[model samples]
Target: MFYAVSAVVLGFLLDLALGDPHWLPHPVRLIGWLIARLEQLIRPVLPKTPRGELLGGILLTLIVVGLSGGVSWCMLHFAAVYLGKLPAYLLEVVMCYQLIAVRSLKAESMRVYRELQKGDLASARIAVSMIVGRDTEKLSPAGVAKAAVETVAENTSDGVAAPLFYLLIGGAPLGFCYKAINTLDSMIGYRNEQYLSFGKFAAKLDDAVNFIPARLCALLMIAAAFFTGLDGPGAFRIWKCDRKNHKSPNSAQTEAACAGALGVQLAGNAFYGGVLFEKPTIGDARRMVIPNDIRLANRLMVVTSLLSLAAFSLMKLLIIFLLH
Candidate 1:
């Protein structure tokens, strides 16, 4: 239990300092590669019918998640049995670090901020495109900034808090399970003609796993807003009012808090693959979204991540104490 707690802390610090350097290989990317390979192998064997595709998706999920969690568990177990606790702890720390993307989220969003600061709307659009799923070709300067902020807000829950929640609950193995689900969803979970039936389980499972952490992260974000002098009451009010603004049950939780805290509207509509998705607007358009809002949203995300770590760590420790 102590090692679990310490791994989370040190992993978080490592992520903050290193922020996913491109030189190092990431397990998540390996997971993604594995998913693609499995999909290629699985799809060819299944029928083209909806039920067949659905069954294929289920098998894919089971294999990917099982392998991810099982491999991590084996690695740690073998390391502890043969090498030492310190080596096992170090492997666990790296595993925990790979599971979360707090610093990477910030660094990616800030590229847009830096581009916008230079008055390079074109460059800003390109930078924002890397992070956002929407079509960025036709976005204006404000649109670029809004997209960046919205990505930061939504990812606060998905990329940071949700992983931390799992890490605290079940250590690195369970955390990898969560990431496998999340990565599968990102890779295949879509309402498009190709994925509608094929990715249903992954999509639903992602929603299920993220439900609690998303709301918890929003609450932490509200408190972070208050502490950072953004707009605590407004955040709470908007969260209460607009938490369900997205088609996704979990995506809007943090977006609403962030929009209200920053005093700008977000998530009205977005073009994806040239098709416009009409999404409900969250928060009132109290002010125009600016490039600086990206920085503020990052601030909120960082603070919320710290609060989640501290709170979940304490919860984990308390549970351990009770168990002992």
Candidate 2:
């Protein structure tokens, strides 16, 4: 357990030192390939009955989970044996931490802000498009800001907190497996006609897995806002009142809290793949979203990350002391 925790810490530090490199093999990508292969193998065996399909989905999910766990275990165990203790420890930590992308999220988000700052609406739209799933072709400056801010808030949970939570609970192998499941859901989990039935399991499983982490992330962000001298109460109110606005039950919770904390309204109508989605507005209509809000969101995200780390460390220490 100590080794597992140490590996997660080291993996995080390594990821901070070295972001994802194009030259090396990415574990997430490898896991994605495994999922693809499993899907192919199971497709032909899918039963005609709903019960059969449900059973098949469960079996498929288990296969994915098993393969992911197996690979992570092999890599971590091999590193521990062949690499020096410190190096192996660091490698494990780096691997675990790399799964969280708070820094890259901030960077990408800030780039959109910078583009908007230069009055480059087109460039800003392009930058925002890279981070969000919505259409950016006709977005105004404020629209771009809102989209970027919302993405930052929602991903703060999906891309960062969720992975860390899994690590704290079960260490690197489980953490990596959680990420694999998440990535698979992101790729295949859709409500569109094509994926509605076929991707049902992936979508539901992702929702179930993310349920706790999303709320925890919202609380973390709220705490972070308070620490940063933002209006925590405002965030809480918005979260409670407007969390139901978005189509995604969990995602809206965090994004609404963030919008309220930042004192900006977010969500209206957005297009995705030419389909329009109308969402209720979150936050009070007090302030217009500007480029500075993106900067503020980034700052809040940094605080949230630090707070989560501190909390994790303290919990680990308490566990060790109790065991001893």
Candidate 3:
């Protein structure tokens, strides 16, 4: 229990100090590669019918999640038995670090902020394009900033909170499995003609897994806003009013909270694949989204991530004590 708790604390420190080094191997990317290849093989075997697609997606989820958990457990088991518990525990720390993404998400958001601050809208569009699914070519400065802020808010739930929730409950393997579901959703979970049927299962699975974590993320972000001197009351109010603005069950929860906290409107019509998508707007437009709001959103996200780390670690210790 001591090593497990230690690994949790040290893992949070590692993520903040060294947000995914470009050189290090990431399990999420590896999971993505596997998903892509598996999709290629499996999609062809199934008919284009919904039943076929559903079964194929179900099989894909089982394979990817089972493989991720089994591999993690086996690796730890072997290391503990062969080397020692200490080495195995340290390996666990590294896995936890790799699994949770707080600082890396903030770094990417700040990259867009830097480009926007330089008065380089084109470059900012390029940077924002890295994080958002919408078309960035014709976005205004405010649009770019809005895109960045929205991505930060959405990822706050999907990337940081969801992973930490899983890690605290079941450690590295479970966290990795959650990442696999997220990766699958990101890659193919869409309403497009090609993915509408094939990606249904993945999208629903992601929604189901994130159902609780997403709401928890909103509450945490609101608390973080309170401590960070943002508009906590506005966040709560807007979150309550517009939390269901997005089409996804979970996407809008944090986005509404964030837009309210920052006093800006988000999610109007946006171009995707050259087609205009008129998304439901969230939060009253008390102010236009600016590049500075990107920094503010990052501050909120950072604080939320820190609080999540501390809160979940304490929860882990409690669970451990209760068990023993």
* Model number with the top TM-score: 1
For residues 133-202, write the lDDT of model 3, one tens digit per residue: 9999999999999999999999998888888888888877888888888998998899998888778888
In model 3, which runs have C-alpha deviations exceeding 4 angstroms? none
Relative to the true structure, candidate 2 reaches a TM of 0.89
Q: Give a tens-digit lDDT track for model 2, residues 1-324.
A: 577666656655665567566686777887788777877777678766656655655676677777787777787788878886776666667678668777678889999999999999999999999999888999989999999998888888888778877887777777877887787677667777655555678778888888988888888889998999888998998988998887776888788879888988988778999899776788887978998999988888778776776677567768977999
Worst 10 residues of 1 by lDDT: 94-103
Order the numbered candidates by lDDT, best leading.
1, 3, 2
Error of 1 at 273 (Å): 0.6
| Candidate 2 total steric clashes | 10
**Per-model TM against the reference:** 0.99, 0.89, 0.97
Tell me the whole-model lDDT of each prediction, alpha carbons only: 0.95, 0.80, 0.89
Off by over 4 Å in 1: none
* Count of clashes, each model: 0, 10, 0
lDDT of 1: 0.95
